[model samples]
Target: MHGPDSLVFKSDRPWPNARLRVGAIVGHATSDSVRLWLRTGGPGRFTLLLYDCGEAMGSSSVRAELRAALGRVPVSAEEAAEALAASRTVPFEVDGYADDTTRVLDLADLRPDTRYGYALHSEDDGGKVILGHNRLRSFRTPPGEDERRPFQVALFSCHMPYRVSGLFRKRTDVGDIDAWDFLAATLDRHRDDLDVVIAGGDQCYSDGVGTLDIWKLLNRSMRREGGELLPDERSMRSWYRDIYRGYWGFEGVRRVFDAYPTYMIWDDHEIGDGWGSHYLADDGPDDGLARVLPDLADRGLTRDDGRRLLRRMFRAACAVYREYQHSHNPPTDAGADPDADADADAERDATGADTDAQDVWDYSFTRGGAAFYVLDGRGHRDIERDGYRILGEPQFRRFEAWADALDPEETPFMFVVSAVPVLHARSALANADLAAPVRAAGIGDDLRDSWEHDLHDEERAALMEVLFRAARRGLRPLIVSGDVHCSAVFSLTDDDGHRVWQLTSSAVTYHVPRALGWALRFGAADDGETPEGYAFRRLALYTGTSYALIEVNPAAREAWFKLYGKQIVEEPGPDRGRRAVPLSHSVAKIRLS
Candidate 1:
């Protein structure tokens, strides 16, 4: 139980590995907390034969137990399954997945603004030991205090670590920039202007990659001419370790998280081929399949066992984060000067300071007069636009209910967040048709799902209807996202005369391939993204090699999006002398008059 390399959950029956986690990875501040999501790696069979035996909620001593030998009690497998099923502390929701590898533990009635401590547990590692141990981890929760605090926010997203193979772009056209390299640069110049950063998604890759696994058949398909193919699971697993280790393992990005409070989520690359919601089957895993094909989505691969591994990684990390936060509280300064530490001053006015003046370490807090709703888009989303359902019925219901429950009568601004930008780029893409065919192709996302595809028009019609209605009701809607790999702004007019603004920032390091994107010159490409750029008028303003300096004045109902150092694509303006420029996109703030 005390060793690092323990036989996590070794068991007699091994198909259904023993351990699955029930926790979340959260980013926090003193005022509120944001839940990345809570998940459990599932498949109920004879997985890891381990159990979570943490000390009581607030204690250091935990009860460790070895349960794998229970078979000697003469209990039948079904009996044991019943007992285990009855012991869970949280509710479970899962679709049949051959890759029945995960069960998530999401938030239910999470407080609006507050700070919390959180963490997770692991069943396996390197070597031998007991089957049970402590559940405590190093992690902090989203800020939960909504006393109307004042804080700065750093925004960004879209970090695709893989360099595009010639299939999508020319290697000579542009080389890849690691995600951390860009973040370090951004922080170098603008660390003083912000509080925390939020990512839209693509945090990890799911599809087989060349750098990680040149062994899988999937990798063969991914390569330009298709050469080496991974012959087995061991090779595939090796790929998983390589690709993931390459990015998350980056020391620079980890520093950013440690330097500033950060919130993250997953999008397409976290899985594979954008719409895996269409998994073809849910039966137990076979040597041939890694993900489960959803019986519902016409047999699309939705539940890859590989995804569960990634999810487990996310949950475990979050747990470690919670453990860290509780153990190491960041220093706070409340002096009139940002440079001074006012211990006496802070103690005296701790409860009296305006919410707006406090630092945002975890969750959404009331700043100025707006309610910033930052949440997970990929975790809760039901395949988008193809009629697959944007938000699942449950999530959608909750969203509307939350909106209805909002006391708009008392609020002025509503800044909503998704790791991915929510604004529809159809108009911009539509404009691309006027450009070269290759560029026009850029307008169409081959991955558009039921949520954004066949039912896109209807979904848009409905979303506008609700959002506009909310605006008329005095709810200013501002949607922010990050997965697009670019930064920009967008606006929409709702039927109710309400205005919608969207702001997007992508990987402080990752960038789009330059060649496949060459259609830019042929069309109205700004930085080679095409008509979408035309629609948003997105200028790369600053290469993310420099982090973004994002500021939001909740009281004033304004948002400032800027890059910290390098200036590449920017709105037409004078040399402001600052490394960061106010991006025109709504990726960060929502202010309604």
Candidate 2:
């Protein structure tokens, strides 16, 4: 089978000056449309040619035609041009200001359940195509919402890229790329079967304020007073841009992104270790900033200064996130306005103090018999506020409305993506005010980040009730999550026997220590009951670099979740090089009706 890597078009002509930094990533797709995201080396006009895989053509025949058009099977430039001209063409422009030339192009009016092969070409100022080598990326538009068909969705999260400087460091040692390679191979093997790929959270870790270079840069910019010397907006944006590029630029990772329609939501690590959960005041008891920089007090950093710094960081992080990640997501309530000014809509306050209704990141979509609601757990989170909400009031209300409106007859399976698991082992340590102790033990703000954390108990209960209500109404609710660096399946059952499942696939690249893995397993081992009398228990668990495939068979009225873990094996070849392969770790089937 030809993987995404083999689809690259080769030519004797010199490569164009304006090239792709990250490969074309297929994102958020509906039956009629799909979004494609790309980052170029510089600002330029580009045209994407999308060729349909004819209904009568088989997979082999389609590949043969693609190869012939690209000259691999002997075709002239004119013939290739003619073939490409027969396909649909979309023209777009990229600018330097938008996260260094990143753009998301939405292709509309596509045929449902159809496969399309697309090639991107740089265009001249006169609107002529600049012919050169480019990869042929493809994605299949989802089946119509009314259609009840079998489809699969891949879920995973918590991607931490390897760092050479921290080679011996425990964290760095476990940050391997093997999982991504395995994921690429897995997606390629099941290309036709898999429809959507959902990255639960922590796509890239901005841990410890990012890499050594970023740390040094931030440190150098910090003043003793932490007033005037805080890193400027440009510096912060540059640091985050570098982090995203470094983490997502891996060859295997790019291949998977290029091949599938992916959806993503950010976790705390996207901005900092525990962005919304930590105290912002320097003198505050649980101030994560003070703990990370123990000498901040001695350096004369005050509470106000810390607040200002954090605000600046948040603004920069959110701005860049919107450009890189949020651009491809389905339009939000506020973002759906076609007449809204793009620049004005992108701007958010430094503190995020106001509930900018326009800043809503949560979105929902339907495919076949399933409905997916991706909650923005990190964006509007307000642990320091009086309400201590996770999704904040505005987004929470939107979610509630979406849940309330779901029709079991139309969408039998509902998946709620929370990034952090909604149902995990209850953490006793998280209930207490042991922030100082936990920080001393190098856990950072993790304990506070949990849904079980005392601060978020109310919000967690509210979310659970909503899911339970959905289940009672006959919708099979499954909460998909990541960020704990472990994989597990948990089910919540109400008195009426209504069930909701939590499927967690995490640390797609990062490794989990044996002790940590065992601890997670043990904590989730015991069955327990929620405050509302709903019993919950761990169904299956796997601690490793892994991902989950949820296959929905609407005709069967059931879904099968198979967790695949990464296993390193030596290839049987002359070089005898080792490679990572995916091995089935666990499987569970849940009834849809």
Candidate 3:
């Protein structure tokens, strides 16, 4: 009867082939604790063992003992699964999830600034067996107050594995190169030097051009007639489960998550294409699917009905998001605290009574000397142009509260993760004559979801003002994002000399269209425009698939962005071979001061 907060290990059924699967992960490490996430093949009990990695402990001796122990033990399938549930000798124990699949363990009593060797084990009625015992891995906790150590973070986004399959036309131009192979090589080479991984957004392309399997699942879930249960709840749950299963299946994503602690946030693709950009207003003629399909505009469902159906679909999607993404982070119980604000409930009522749905993913955490403010920008947006709000009232207030509580002088670097690019090239497709019919039909608003859109000017200004205030207070604001499909570095300095950096790394496995990439880099008038009171610049740009590594040297008072790209190479011979080769010369480095 262990609750969600407490760790429990039980495996009702061992997966048929019991190959451990761990991916789609995010880990948050504090001074004294580390939260770990893992996904298994099937239901079963498992054990996690953590050992201190220090010079005093002879590494060779430890390895020899573990190997000998593993070789001596013999385990049957049922015994392996049952032994995991029955054994309670490990330092930390958790019963596998109901299906004995996924588990998030919050491990305590860990030393700060220390790297600990770790292992996963499966036990059953007959014996105890180690899982992936041969591969060595370790998790490093945050530094203590007196420790000052240079740490590195890996940031990347928009991982759509299906893009390389060429089953979809929009990304047909993508070369045969598989970016994941490059990522796997890069991470393996630099795994020891990396501290934590920050996955900006679009980890799974829930909605994208090439995701046929996802759409197939969704189609099966939806009721053909489109009723209250337009999407069967059971089918929606299975779809989300399969999404994670398929996404974590990638070896690149799996290798990183298995080795390091990752922190993640979601973007439009997590729910659907351009989620929150479409409001489905009940009083408007722009019903949900009708705008896209001309004939359906006046046929079956009314505007109110459409809104209801969309709400249900969104609820289902949010539920899955909460279970997989938000549950691992800091608790959002502040929203329910009565004493915090007497009128909080009233505020929530006026803003729209879905407070839980909107605020669960917005949270703040402190590690070492830096703080992370992760935003749920896509969850609560109100696309109506009248009074535009990208982050509805509740989440915005929560962000303000987190900012107000920060003591900038003590925390020199503040990391803010926004799934979508805050500073982006103005859309060339936003105001085209060919898209006018789509605009008048009420769905064109989705095209203008960026911060620079005229409709969202006020909101963008407000966001900038907050960052300016933070900058003035001595916080070097570094915003990391990934949704644009092209990686770039942009910065803005206000009249007060307050500076903020937007380092966007995107499409870890997909290519940006050559024409659109060129337009974003050169054709746009606002590519490097400076506003009235600020100095703006585009420091670097990369249109190919890549990831950004931000290394902060506190003592030196400097930070730099290292962007890496993958090159496709072909060997010419009778035994022709094609492989992804790391292009060392194309490395783009930009200094932040």
Best by TM-score: 2
lDDT of each: 0.39, 0.68, 0.60
lDDT (Cα) of model 2: 0.68
Alpha-carbon lDDT of model 1: 0.39
lDDT of 2 by residue, 1-593 (tens): 11121112322212112223646778899889998887765677676767775654456665566555553333433444566554676667775444557778889999988888776656433333222233456788888877788998899898875543345542222246677877877777777768889988888766522333343444445553322434445556656776676677677777888778899889987877666777765455676666545444665666555555566566667776777788888876432222223132223223444323358788888878888999988877766777736788777788999999998888888999999887774632332444344445555356567777777877888888899899889899988999877888878898889999988898787633323333454455446776667787766777777887898976666898878886667888798987665654433444333
Q: Which stretches of candidate 2 lie over 4 Å from their true place?
A: 1-20, 55-85, 124-134, 164-175, 208-216, 224-229, 292-301, 333-358, 427-444, 511-518, 568-579, 583-593
Superposition TM-score, candidate 2 onto the true structure: 0.83
TM-score of each: 0.51, 0.83, 0.78
Candidate ranking under lDDT, highest first, comes to: 2, 3, 1
Per-residue lDDT of model 1, residues 1-593, tens digit only? 11111122323211111122332233434333332333334322222221222234234322122233222244443333343332222323343321213222333343333222232222223222111112222223333334333445666555454444566532322234443655655553444334456655565554424333222323232211122211222222323333333445444554455344555544545544443333233342221123322221232223433333233223222222222221122222211221212232233233333221232222343443456555433433343224415444444454555566556645556666655455433323345464465454543333243223444445445544555667777777766675544455556553334566666665555444432123322232232221212123333322243344445555455555554433335445676344443233322333323
Q: Any runs in candidate 3 off by more than 4 Å, and if so which?
A: 1-26, 54-100, 125-130, 164-178, 188-193, 209-221, 224-230, 282-288, 291-305, 333-355, 385-388, 427-446, 511-532, 568-579, 583-586
Best by lDDT: 2
